[model samples]
Target: MAIFKHLRVSDGVAAQGDGKLPAGDPDPPPAADGAHGPPVTNEPGSTKAWTWRGDFGASLVVVLIAVPLSLGIAVASDAPLVAGLISAVVGGIVGGLIGGSAVQVSGPAAGLTVIVAGLVQTYGWAATCAIVAAAGVLQLVLGLSRVARAALAVSPAVIHGMLAGVGVVIALSQLHIVLGGTPQSSALDNLVELPGQLASNHTLTVATGLLTLAVLIAWPRLPQRVRVVPAPLAAIAAGTGVAAVLGWDVARVDLPSDPLAALAAPQWPDASWTSVAGAVIAVALVASVESLLCAVAMDRLHDGPRVNLDRELTGQGAANLTAGLLGGLPIAGVVVRSTANAKAGARSRRATVMHGVWVLVLALVAAPAIELIPLGALAALLVAIGVQMVNLSHLRGVHRHGELPVYLLTMAGVVALGLFEGVLIGLGCALLLTIRRLASIAVRVTPQHGGPVRVAVDGSLTFLSVPALLRALTAVPEKAVVDLSLNIDFMDHAGVTAIDDWRTGYERSGGTVRIDEVREHWYAPGRSGLPRPVRRTPPVRNRAAWHPLAATLSGRRQLEEGTEEYQSHVAPLVRPLFSELAHGQRPTHLFITCADSRLVPNMITSSGPGDLFTVRNVGNLVPRHGEADPNDSTIAAIEYALAVLPIKTITVCGHSACGAMDALLTPERAGNMPYLSGWLRHGSHSLDRLATRPDGPDRLDRLGRENVLQQLDNLRTHPAVAAREAAGELELCGGYFEIAEGRLHILSPAARVPV
Candidate 1:
């Protein structure tokens, strides 16, 4: 009745003829102390009491495993067994208290065993310890400065691959220890000895190791209650028990005389500075990798929260320093143990602290009993840990993705060289691949509907991307109006030149080229920072009333015929084209083209001087309205043709095989000629449009045609042209001058005009 709370207890008791009390309140009664149960702690999910109990239970489990493993790992590392135990205790106590994550358990790990052993042999234990302490200080500094995120910047593939390689090394190296055989001095030796050892070793020892591995692997699949028991612990206990009962002469820990005697505090010597410095560096690097990896893993496991990595590093550093002071080996956040604690229902850092307490109690009170644990069995446990870390499925996936070269190189490099060196090589390769990817990028060319051929460039277009762009542009028909818009997010010098050259060539062959809005200063102007304006002789007020002799004398060819020979020869030859203009006859259209020798607009247009008024430039560009300087002779000619010549239509023509267009199309050479590159970008739009078309002589023809249309559009922006066109006093047209065929193709009035 009391358990059910608010039940009719009095009535139930009366029915039973025994009255205890009446439960009248709806709420449950307070505990025996007349207070509500302890308020819930900040631990994740569980209530305070439940979380505390879980921590105690998980800690008990961790301690049972940490003690034996720590001692064995230290012995394997060639450091004093006490060092490992001290590290575990300090890592558990300090790291748990100060570190950012709640569930992480810190202890000496197998990954660092080789490094520790080597450093101890070379630097001596005291110096090694000092180095470890220095590393700790470094880590603390890094953590305090909040730069621990630097570790995350390392590529994920490289990090995982490195860890997998380490897993292999650990598994291979521990095989000898598990078989009651001493491993060789170096990893290479160990690798070479593997085949012989497998062949000659006692089948019984190998069988025992294999069985141990199988149990650890299978244990996780068992029921939840049984799964709570650490697999490594179970494997060790079973293997050791079997070895003992079978009377196998397997290698076992060589306990010190008075096992507790080795537990003295670590001593620092004046001469130990060198060793200490080395150890600290090694420890800092190893611990940082381990701790940060564990923190990231923990963040994933606990979907609700994440750890502050810098704070975590600081805590780990403090732990290592404490461990060194306590005669312990270096420690790091161990992923396996942290994961185990989480699965065991640990809700807070209290679990880590509790685990430390258990290590302390067992080390002080039951040191003798722990000595019975066999080293071979511990080796088996490590072999299992190493296997678990390999992530074979992920490796297989990497291989399937055709990244085997990178994967294998990383694996082989790490195994053959060392973790850091191998990873660096892999990183270098990855960087090369990245650069290749960037270099291979090409401009995106899209065809527009009933408009100029428009091409869009997304990534940076540089010299590296030129060939591809050229091929794309040349693919389009030269007759298409190329609304070549170099709306580029980024463009280098080479890209500018390629575009310019393409435009020049295209315009020379009679193409309409239009460049959309360009970034200001993308191109430079002439000496006056503006396009040179076209100049023309004052127009006759009344052509009909003008004298024939004066009109003939004022024509372009006549003006150039200052010499008597020019007057007597060239002027007479050109007299026919000028006679109509002299009599006040107006040409219907004007043609604009490049000044390249290959492109003679008059010859391509097949129009005599009076029939076709033309302006020529290296890159046939129409200066924006008002951007023309007074001295820009080309501009003056264009203005005169548009405003004073009584021309009804204007044609901006481009030609193929033009040098300036070629320059505009190639941007890589921009750095060498900064001003020219900047100037050439003005024609980039037409070049881009050309790039979208198919490559061929025909494509160049298309570019030339498109360039003409673009120029016509450019003319429409001119105030006089716009006003005249709007007033129906003038018309606009684009023409493609094909240099190869020695022909002109008119691209307006719904017909292609041939010359």
Candidate 2:
């Protein structure tokens, strides 16, 4: 006993907010930052020291991907190529300095291309720039009002469907450019003109576009070192290089002789006030939603400081204002470069800011080199990106939530009608679906040959379901006899009155009706002219009916009443589960525990039917192979369970203040009871093990834990248990239950106490 005196134990399970742990156990340790060291504090306004190496390297990786994408987006929007470059620089520098997100990169996004193209067509480029600036001002006001988070209340299905529709439109229009032809005004026109464009052979342009697509598809499968260069840059460069060397006649990028001379100031539109205001609001809301959603999405890619959405919205407004003033396209957070930034090991906002500086340098010095790229290659890149936006993963998620109809309707509306109208349609459909689900109810009737006919009602009962409920009640014939059970979870005033009126009429038609409410007493209160009960819990039963009192009733009478209660209230609810498991069982674990009146195996394990195979005996003992009585039942039960069932694990449980352990302490008390004394002999090894350790305050608790551990060892002495354990086909565990504390402590095999 002295060897075990210094052992320490910790709680495995205890009541929440109990303010207690094992006597000498230490508190759990804090989580570590990473395998390297503590996180670097280089966020936008942080005061701690900065780490430059990771951020500088990540910036170089992001800048290479941003330059070509900016040129392509501007081409697709029909804006001057320099406008795309201007927005990239402004978004990176200004957005990185003031935005709430630590690593999200901002630039012109593909999602805004449809709206921007329509605006430019109607108002001209200069007027479109003014509208963008106005939108920026509105965004700034909304951010200042601290209503940024409320924007996320819009349904995710609508947002995703809108993006998918935009992708479809972009792909249809850009496909014409890929075939060396001008795109038509709308998606439908582009689709209709596709065959005519395909008939006229533009061999060199088609060759370059196909080459670009091939390179983009095959780039990811290359070696890691080769993939360090992005797929977009490599694909475009491959197409451009082959078209240059072979003297192929393809459409090349056309930029102004001097890139700095392309900057232009925006002008006010000549349209009416209402038209201008509508365009401004559309740009503001779309940009705000896309950027905020992108910020939330990028947060999942890193363990950095969370995005401050309000600050992020304000920063996006500032960037757009600068872009619109300098003749750049509308700017928002971009997912492509942000993913690259995270994958490149960016630690802070420094990476985002530095990447913008690199793009500024590219626009200044590499204008001639960028002009060498073919327009066909850029068109091919946009086509691939547009097609990917209709993601299959998004479709599967919406289908699982039963929102696929809303999603499909929104997408169809956006493509056929317009973006705003499509979103309104989606909102209306979602409202209707919600109302339909809330008003659903079900009623079922069953007839017994000799007993009363059983009728059950489930779900919420409201005025919407009253008509349906009455129709179901008509299914019962004039009702010779009836047992009506109301298992409804909710009932309104109209519903209770309906049920009461039916019962009164049925009884008057020469029939007997007995009403039993399992969940609530809605009908009882309504018939008594009393107000409905505020609490949802069922009415409490009288304890005196089943309490073990000799003066009140005999033991047989109490047992019969308890059986009747179970049959009347619980049988119908559990009937389905019992019917499913009636034919066979495949329990995963075999539970062995004491046959104590207070220790319920199922309650302690929190397992339902067909989850555990249980064995119970006094002292919770298992006899060893060498030492066993002639008619041993515990050993035979173990053999049968291991041989017949698919049991993965076996558990031995012992409890505190156990009567068997107390009897072992004073064996003379059980000398007169032969059968009890013989059964207690199987726990002799536990007493020997306890004797070797020094006694402490909780001797009974320690002996009970030792008995659980000893029983696990005894189980291994069987040939089947030993062979299965050695082959890793089975596992053994020990648990000690403290009756007074109502806690179960898991025991470790290597130690004598619970761990």
Candidate 3:
């Protein structure tokens, strides 16, 4: 809950890519910069009375657009014509009263057409209403929980693929109605009968449908004043005229003369719990996502109050609950009406409430006129909407991101199978794409000036990428030295065997295959086929961290003496965790240690990159508190580490075999080397304390522990460390590494037992 407190409220401008609008509706016109801003009104929370006249006028504009779309969506959903109007009325009144978005119009949306249709087919129209009611309950729960914003995180690829699939299915099934025939049992059935329907003489309904489709396409490009009537309304009116003039026997919408007769009670779903749950979740999630997306788009076109996403979700739920109970299709924030409302300059949510009032008034007053509208005309409208869903622009965009296959597969699946199946397939494909990208391997071969090709493989070279690797290897010219460089993080058994087999085969074919590794060691130097055997740490008496001496002794040392232990043992144990940081480190502790070879702090302390900000020198020391000496590199590293990193802990780790300590403790110092003698001066206090130790012979070991405590005291003198320690944000710890015994001990005030 705390993590989500700062959840972002985006304008969802890119959500238009999700196709929230009715097919073919141009993007909402943008308002002039500050046209309705400050000079026209006060800031967002202003209490000035709004212009009711302006709101009412704008309500009429949205009502004109919502009526035809609602009717068409209901028809596509296989519900009575009045069900669409009921949804429009309830969405306007209930949602407007409580919605977060002031200008967004709430009604039946194109996105839910296929979902509603399927519900109607499975459980009948009355039971489908119950499903809508159940979905509304879910939406209410999500909104109240304040998790509604999280729904917007659904991948754009899945959403677009889903809508495109819905569009294809809607077109195929509704094409049957446009051709003067009832819809088939399934999309596949409809597709099979489509050719036969085309061959028959269904002339009049086809003519009406074609004219309706034509008007919808042409109406928007007409003269400015005439365009006030929405394209859907204009197209429907023209189609009605054409049908009446021809005296054709076409399937027409038959609504009761008295609108009250449209009311129907919800029926309990007669199905298994799993199916019912699926239906409820589907409607709730899809409606919530689409509504929220529309609300965000509406906020962009208006200068009024921005949409409070949770409240918008709650409002949609209330409207859907009301619509479902009243025998209506489920409702959401309709983008077409929402965008139109903003463009018309509606002052408040009053415009949306009034639009609902208009729809209710129209249903009673205009029942006879509504009954005259032909089903073919509505089907034709749906056809255009569906066809628009197979968007070329959206396709091109998805293709650029390599998601074209997802879109195509989804669209095909919907047409061939069903809505949920198509969506699942598309989501599966998108998931695969994401996984491939995350686990992607890059195999490159650069032809050198005079040498053979330099083959480098980056990322996790697992079995999935073996085919490509083999092809690249096969392309190498014969009798050539292949400089193979593997900058990979992981290589499984299959990958290792494939590469090994290829290398041997290539070398046997008169070619020299030289294998080199940057991050991963494929195999040992002499043994080329198998992975190098490693000596894993054995159980210790105290179960402590890996001892540096043990690590150094277990493995055969490398040809290079100093790095032998690390390269063969320590490096392998740590490379997997730190190889990604080959780029950089973001350590929190600045571990200042001596440069003595045997004193391996990482091996003793069990630390890696990003765990520590380290500075090693002759004597692990901090020079002065508030002053910077240009010659002191130790002081400069301290300052840089403290300032640049999120360093909370500063550790000065001193050791037993420290040459710098010996130089300081000895009577005969490096008299010939003045620079070294001067550098040893920083540890003078630790040397003076060593002589006072009661243990005479073991004073050298005691000096190591005392030296760490002295460095810790020196660290506090720095202004940066002092300030942070005072604020209780930074910690200064004293520690020493016992080289001969291969153990570590902590020194708070004095050296204690091994820690």
Candidate 4:
């Protein structure tokens, strides 16, 4: 066992960048030395040493399940029973020793049964083997050329549909054998003959088949300890025992006296070269796809090494070549055996090779015992496997992604025509769907009799949509005004040329046209001759007029112009978010700040559109629960915040050079201003604290920090605020922003001064 374990070759392995091996991730160097060590699972993305103990135990579990499944798949393909065991051995020994994935087990999968059966019928058994060998050579070339990853680009819907179609064909044909009747060649023929086969009486065979299926279904639901024996093995054993005890006359599995000596050899077919080449390509593509898909699925089952896909493809090619020359069925990575190996704690490739060794040994020594098992039992087992292929969860996912049409057409093509034809149909459907979606651009023309006509274009603007744009433009009357707002997310040269030509021709006829690009500038750059933009860069907003010059216009005119700019350029882009917020506001923070013109809460906090619930009053004050007038709007706002919105944090922000704080210090400043003096009374608490703690660079700065702290204390006076704070559900924070330096300081209760 240990001698065979050293045969794992380092073909595509390379050390990762972190200077440490990934835990249980095998990337052995060329001499195969230092491969074994103490296994440990460290932090995420860390490496551990490989262990043989896990591999040895996992091989036993996988081999037990592989033996029965291998024989059944070969029987379904209408080939010699020994061919199944031969493929099993080659898939494990050659495939595992060099394959990319650490734990995925390869064998004769049920997915290729229909293809193999067709090959055997068209080109004799020996000639089919020769075709398989040729396909293996093609796969080797593909792997070496590093095109293995490109196969994954095929849609998963097409792949799933192909498997489901194959499963249906296998189940239909295998059902005939379970019912003690000969199966017809195609799936349709089998269905047409099923009713008559069911009418004929075959009580003993039916009993044996029912017993096998019952055990297969019931084994999984049993206690965990009893299920240590694999379900397939247990199900077959029970059915065979009953048949022998009843002394029923039934067809049973037949094997040569010496299985190794009776192995078939490949031979060239005497058919057309074109037909043979098609067979080879079909076999190569289907087997490659099945094995690659299985390797990806098995990777999610273990925390061991990630599969090296290109290396795995090369290994599978070598295995298929060996299996074909030795007169075996085509091989692929089998999910059942691979899943068993992973669940049984397999850690390395040693388990995969050892399972093959076990199968080879059993075929050489256990010929007589295997012959005792009935063929009906294997057929019954296959029926269950076939039914499971049409998965409901996969159907739902296909529907959700809008690929149901492709999936259904592929499955129908495979069942009615063949696998290759079905795949071509599916690919065609997917291409048409993609082209339709890309060309479906939106062009709306809103015409006004005496005013400027509005034309809005959305979606990708390509050559396909150029006609639609021109038709909408022709609707506007000659010598009329037009506003063409292009909110295009993507565009090509043809689309740009179409729009430019239309605008030039229309303006020559005495029409006015204005263009506004909302987000991406795909048109303006080309029209201005500023080196046609290849990338969709955002249009920068010019803020030169934010503080307009006296010669330019008054401040009121500047504000009105800003509003017009927002409506023409920014409104369409932000409309989606604003539409959702129109229903209600769900602000998470309640912000209390001074009513100073310089303090913009949204800009300072970096929030936009219904993020902050703000309350601005004189002194940035939050009066104690009942101190102010009963009709106070500030108190009412706080009560509404606590009662309605999901407010989690309450922030009080104070700033430097505050006019309110200066007013608080000098009563004479506000002596004549009645409203200003009345609002200054709220700063009395902040004034008392200023005298107790006077350590600052300036009186105004010191008063600002004290006011922020005093307001936080006053907020706790509310019953809801006090209760939520005591329970640790709500938080209170203080911040002070300096105007000159543009810096913010966070204040805590322990420190009277800002830090």
Q: Which parts of model 3 are misplaced by more than 4 Å?
A: 1-36, 39-54, 245-249, 443-755
Q: Compare candidates 1 and 3 on lDDT and give the better one.
A: 3
- Against the hidden reference, what TM-scores do the models get? 0.57, 0.73, 0.57, 0.71
Q: What is the lDDT of residue 246 in candidate 4?
A: 88
Candidate 4 residue-wise lDDT at 557: 56
Q: Per-residue lDDT for 273-302 in model 4, tens only?
A: 999999988888888888887788777766
Candidate that scores best on TM-score: 2
lDDT values, one for every candidate: 0.64, 0.79, 0.75, 0.79
What C-alpha root-mean-square deviation, in Å, does candidate 4 show against the real structure?
Answer: 9.6
Tens digit of lDDT per residue, candidate 1, span 277-338? 65566568767876787677665544323687888899998987777655567788876567
Q: Give me the overall lDDT of model 1.
A: 0.64
| Ranking of all predicted structures according to lDDT, beginning with the best and ending with the worst | 4, 2, 3, 1
lDDT of 2 by residue, 1-755 (tens): 12211111100011001212112111123237432234435785332333366678889998988888888888888888888898899999988998898778888877788888888899899988888888888888888888999878888778778877777777778878888888988777888999998899577898898898788767766888998898889988999999999989888888787777888789989999998999898888888888888788777766657899999999988888888888888888887777677767776789999999999999999888999899999988887666666655577778888889888888888787877888788888878876675577777777755545667787788888888899999988785677677877777789988988898899999877777676776777877778767654524444463232424556675575457556756786789999999999888798899999778787777887888898899889999887887668887778778999898899999998899999998898898999999888889999998998899998988899889989998999988999999999999999988888767779987786777
Cand. 3 Cα-lDDT: 0.75
